[model samples]
Target: MKVIPTACTAALLAGTAMSSVAQGVYDDALRLDPNSYETLTVTVDGEPMAVRRYEAVYVGNPVAMSATQPARSMGPGGSPASADGQELADLLTYQKMAIYVPEASIEDQSTAMIFAVNNAGWFASELRTSVETGGEYVSTSDTDKVGAALGAGYVFVDVGTRGRGIVAADGTAAGKAPAAIVDAKAAIRFLRLNDDVLPGSAERIVITGTSGGGGLSTAVAASGNASDYFPYLAEIGAAGIDADGASSLNDDVFATIAYCPITSLGYADMAYEWLYQAQRDEQLTGVSLEASQTLRSQYPSYLESLGLVLDDGTPLTADNMTDLLMQIVTQEIQDHIDEGGSVPALGEMFEFTSRGQTVEVENTWLSVVDGQIVPFEIQDFLTFVTQTSALKSVPAFDRTANSGNEGVDGENTLFGPAAQEYSNFTPFGWNMNEVAGDGSGADDTGLKWNEFVETKEGQAIAAQVKLTDPQAFLQGNADSAPYWYIRHGMIDRDTSFAVELALYRAVAGTDGVKDVNFTLPWMTPHSGNYDVQEAYGWLASVLSDAE
Candidate 1:
């Protein structure tokens, strides 16, 4: 039998439990107290909307219990408590979650709960603290995005998650790769545990986020209820895990909404190189030509390995990758033209000229053959690409220590382990180190990719990368959400266009995925919620169909 934790555990999970329960006893009471909320006002569409705000609610006991406490007992999921407790207090701070229920429609809740995954560039974030210290419950921009949901009576939940660059008081990395996603899944389980008292249907959860948050959103959507994450969830004492790492309550979501997600980090570096290798300027980009070409060479096999398919069932290959990308770009241009937006003149579009010779308006970026805009020369398109967006350094992510911007690359920090501050998580990074001898301590002679994977350390990093692999999930390796809404801007430049396209294809090609509404907003940057009405409309349609 499970023990219902004392007020101390209740206080933390429900609101503010500070008193100790029993030694060695897990805080298994993960449900929220419905009465422990105060009505607060949030601005939705410039109107003051009343909402019942439940703040700083811990989803589950992430730390292990002390031996002096009560004897350990099984929780709902029945997994044994075993995670380290050294950073328990601090970890709880990042585990807290907030829920906002519209006061007017609490009795008439929407069909689903919307989990607004916070984006701090995948770095350590404190959502509950931000609200406690007088900041808005959610950002104004976020409010704008979710206003439709709030107005429609959906519960808006913002769950705190740990990320890279956070260290515990014990000098251990508190938030690292997979930690944020783990916290996210735990919060979902917590909501499922308390589904009876929650304002909306916990079974139908929709996750929405942008950029790094978008990446995590994809991770959460893809890896739903997969056994791969069970161990991590069990370590955190999340409410729903059994002896066999099975949970009665599932972590699967109904849908996902991601915008400009910098995802698939394992392939991002290679994709970046493959997309922009021709446009890279060695002196301007500060990356060696050899390093760039070496990384570029590895992309073909990686691209083919995904086995991505076009909507018409054509296999996506490196040879035709440019064709698909061009199709997406030309379609976006044609869409803007149809919307009465004028394409920039050749002079304004191209950033550079060939020896002071201005390019012609016709047959440049686009042509008016028979008075209809058609995609012209690939060179013109490539030129516009170089002109519009700046290229990232060679091997965009997982930069090695000697890769000019060492100690500062976010992706390096992301893939690094707790004790280590930075690491090369990608084969491109590793191979580049070997080729350029950039002082990453790689074998100077040569480091074979297959040999690296055979090592224990390589196996560990591969596991970490697998945790964030959407392709693995979408390709029938795990349960993925049926509905997906993804948006990538035309000029984002954060990652290769191939990244988003690959994700789109993965979802669109999957058997069970009901719908995928993907768009490339013209001239948009790496951002989200630009088309809130359309996004919400899509959400409403899907929810309605689900009913």
Candidate 2:
């Protein structure tokens, strides 16, 4: 066991006193017996928990290339650097992780592990703090849904990640584009590196998360072992080994379970407008009808550009988007009714009488066939969904100005790092004049935009959006997980249904993507991991096939 003092110093200084003590004990044990496995008591949220600790293992920090080492920098192009030729300071965010194995001997256990993440709204500072405390430690209570796994002998590991809204005490933008994804990959590498000492089969790791965390899970699965993220991984000192004269141990997972994932960032706004355009005439707060119309007009071209097709090979176009949505929504309702759940009464068909003009809306997709609404229509479903108001303003995601404050929304903040307050994420939101076309700035929210593409910050912002999106991997430019379980709520207006649909098509349509189980749960909201038993069964099936 070779202990690197510098890496250890970095971890010890960044971590708490209790962590230092635990690392010290683990280091001593490693020195005495290289293959020893030990448990340490660590405090999480002021609660004491017992677990195996592997603290402060350096992966490898990114350094400038010299004549002696020409290949020091790895993964993707456009590696960020300081003018002084020094690498970004390591150890600031390079922390340790704890592992928990079920009650079993280390050598006799081959339990599968869950790499659970806690990220919502793309901000991960809270999660990162939790990891430093004790690696997102889980207890028996966490297995309420998936207790079958633990009861049947499985392991659970929580991962802490850096996200879009983190500013270091020194004001450095530590959590930015590629930062969260890079940390995720590093954590996976750490697990694989210590697979021998850990009780789980390293090859059977399943990634899980909800919302933004779900987006990350999908991204990790889609971009597995791709060299595009290597530079960021190396920057954070991720674990790797030399194999066949090349760096090996890339972060790849066996399967992914993403619930209500907010992905396809580039096309979310268009999808939102296209889906909810029918409600444009209705009075709603924080919504701009003109802005909705403008974005709605642009959706057709974008939808056509994706080249996505249905399972039967029909091109998914704006012309048939309504029908496509109805098909999925109907299935969701039918599934619920089949499970013996009663459908709410919103009337089989209704007439919205507004301003002395009555408009008849037929429940085209759903009807009261045999006195039972087994399937529901899009209009009635949306009426129930938007009963109060629209979830977001026109051009929901990339708001020009922050509706809450003088700044921008979280999605906008996600594009630019924590250093800069916020910037525009999409080109549609780039030129307010173009999106609105009519020269009306009524929908513009006063958000900042990088008008000049030649600027360094502008270029970096564009690159970050491209890198964070999961669609690139689904397109087959990178590796993807063999099995996937993706679910989104039918009424989740946090992101457009188009985003999830596009992702499903990309994964299912692509060659070599073995299995994809996609569903839009009836009447569900922005949530994840609620169906633990079903997920456990899916995990069992995948593992069974592997066996």
Candidate 3:
């Protein structure tokens, strides 16, 4: 295959790698067979910058298969392949492709495309990555399954963005949002270039994903308002025209299905907040609301309440608590922090119970409830935390956070991407004010995003809100075919089909959608894990029906 440089650089800034790819000056690729393969060189500018390896797949099979053995999906080179069933294989695999290197330190617009596949796979449908879960890859991208589906008289293909890693330019990328538009355009282009992908039928497209990937599927399927949400991605790197010689997001996607998808980054904070409490006590899901209020109410107080005690039990008052909180929080968190320009420091503390001196500390601002402890100047505490965190807090945090926040800002607003003017870059949710909202500690993002989709107001502002009520939410926009698919895991004892319940309530609503389709099985993790047979089965079914 070949290396295609895309408009979006995979890497962020110099010191900050948008992804794990180490910046290098050399960028080289190799082409073999119809599908071109590029070798990412490890050097740049006549000198070697650190070169890193990334995993990518390419399929030579036809597009349309819905069922295939997973292990057999890998191509000769271990490039990304497919395992879709055979019926759909003979449809979309064709020559000629357009690829963009979404991001990198090397170059922008270094893009290519050789032979392409309107392929599908039965993998979790998406590859995911996380230090905790390892970099997850989309199993569904496997073309074998797409080819197999072709034999079944169906055609399929996947569109994705951010070629290899992620770029942190925007504030909402936990690795999902930024890549959304790019991937969608790529897939649409793949369809246009191929003879099999119905040139006039963009709405026939079927979108699917699992877990976080599922959320991606839903976002891409975006139905009618595709460009409205991410207008930035309206046109791909090197786009081509369709039968009418006109471009269309309609040829883009017809339907979308995500298995355990997290469609809105705005909701991440709420989800994580609830998740944190749930970890401590399953019944404490309500605590997320409490935490939101707690952080909000206490933030300003901390800003105005910075101080230090003169080695005794007394205290010294200061106006800017930001210094103290920033100092102490950084000290408390160490190496596990997300890199940023100037993160504020407030509502933080350094535990100094070591020296034989004890100090009484009480404040409505911070969470330091321990009566008498150690004594250290608030400013000293901040410096110690931010500077020495890599050494001190890393170990301490790793141990304490066994059940607390990862300090990595998994989804909590406190650590989500920073926002700016071009903020509307992403749709289906928040703005800079919402993401990096008024030092409220964390932005109250995606507030009621899921339900907005079904409302007329939601559709009008589809580019702004992240909502879901496909039927009523879509107002008269939905087809009368009460179609719906419910996926539940018998293995997920987590509230016994919580996803199904949420999906059903969130979509079906009191109005109840017509022609609804639902499926539940003894598979899938408790919302986060879908790495089993159940996941593959769910994807195959969803894609098949959508096709």
Candidate 4:
């Protein structure tokens, strides 16, 4: 016989002891104490699975702005009215989250929490679906990170968020531009709301992820309770709002550890071209020299617009951009060499005539220090980078068929809804005219193009782009997390190296941000959260500082 805890017992177990009793009385008890949960034993594929279900705990009151309209209806499907003529509000859409506390007592262990979000390629609807179905709450001992965090007494929160490409059951675009970010903030708020009942220091939460997930993590750290997201948050019925029109919970996080974040969306295309155009080898596949050059030319002005300066307060201009990047790359390589790691030979196959004889040179960029190649030249390393082929066509992020032969890129899909597969997120990708009388352009389809910038839809898309970019938050426009740990791979071509550099400069250059550690791991590629030991160390330091 399975022993189930009553709602009263569960509530008491939160602060005291856990005692098991009869299971049949749970339903009546749960209705009285909605915040209570119960654990059940079930058989799945002949294996006994102990599952804890925490259901329908209202984060905040759901009410309509006016009596005429139905109470704030938002969720997977269109807010449909019930048969009895009452609006059924689905709090599960953006208001719900699951906490997986370890078996060990949390008070005896560390008080840190990990809010892990699963997202890739700037699309996240699938992850949200998994959370709603209780899929992500599986055994946490599978991975080293999860196991280690659990062993160290950290609570794991599986956050359900809405992102681009998530079409509702009613065929409406429920998850779009600001939905993902808004949902993330709401999840953080949920943790803060249950701080006393939950088993961790809500203030010491560490948000971590890779790629687009990493980007969102950075965004969450950078924009904490920024008023810009309030409208969207209200639209989805996010938790923590009081009847007096005040927020009862905070959405701010203690620290952020992002890896290979595909961020700075609006300017990523130009930055990619500026860094890789010189390396364009036509023989390689997808190499568009004309398109690359056109996009590369726009980077200088865009860099100037950011008004970004180096640590020494030097303006970041297009003229000095290449040199600056080279300096960073060189330093990373030198650091590797200093740590007793081998520096890879450059210009290995390049033959040069020395005294009327052809000689194959290796380590051409390196300088000898005490019989060892310790120092390297920036220009030579740059020459090596330039010889490589470009990753994408011109206007990589928001690729337009009219601009180049390439199809719609991932970012274009991210900007549009499921109904529209691709749309231009930036003005640079917008074509003035279309094919013949139709706005098809060279792509032979009107769907790939964007509406006029002055149009309502166009304005909305532009706003979303700004709202999603992390740079907007770092510019003092929003509240930022004090501690940050950022890492990107050296050879990752998914986005430009300059994009990550810009992020670093923003954090390092900013006044209030603290304990910023930005690094480019040698030969690491388009990934994150590698080096778990170092991350744990950073977490320790952050926790100490918080105390």
Off-target runs (Cα >4 Å) in candidate 4 are 1-96, 108-110, 125-143, 242-248, 281-287, 344-390, 416-419, 432-451
Q: Write the number of the candidate with greater TM-score, choosing between 3 and 4.
A: 4
Tens-digit lDDT track for model 1 on 1-547? 1111233233333432112222112225676788889877666656677888786545445532222211222211111232343323433556778887887767754457888776546664445321222223322243265566776778888777766655554455566677788888888888877777778888789998877888889999988877666667756667666433445667889999888887898888778777776676433344556667667788899888888999788999888887887888788877877878776555455222222244322324665444377657654666555555556666677765535544445476666456665567776566545324432335542555456768766666677788877877887844689899999977677788888888999888777789999878776656677777778778889999988
Top lDDT model: 1
Ranking by TM-score: 1, 2, 4, 3
CA lDDT of each prediction against the hidden true structure:
0.67, 0.60, 0.29, 0.59
RMSD values for the candidates in order, in angstroms, are 10.1, 11.9, 21.8, 12.7
By lDDT rank, best first, the candidates go 1, 2, 4, 3
CA shift of 313, model 3, Å: 63
Task: Judging by lDDT, tell me the better candidate of 2 and 3.
Answer: 2
In angstroms, give how far residue 501 of model 1 lies from its true place. 0.9
Pick out the ten consecutive residues of candidate 2 with the lowest summed lDDT: 69-78
Clash counts per candidate, in order, are 9, 4, 114, 2
| TM-score for candidate 1 | 0.81
Tens-digit per-residue lDDT, 1-547, candidate 2? 0112343334334541221112211222222122343565544334554544334332444211121111121111111212333333443332334455444434544677777766666555222222232333333333243344434456666565666544454554456666667777877877766676667877878888778778888888888876656445544456652211112565778889888887777668878877777775575445377667777788899878778899899998877776777788777767777788654334454344322355344333444455456554566566555642345776777775522223344377676644455566666566552333221122443333544444555566666776677777776744578788998876567787777887888888766677788888755566665566677778788778877
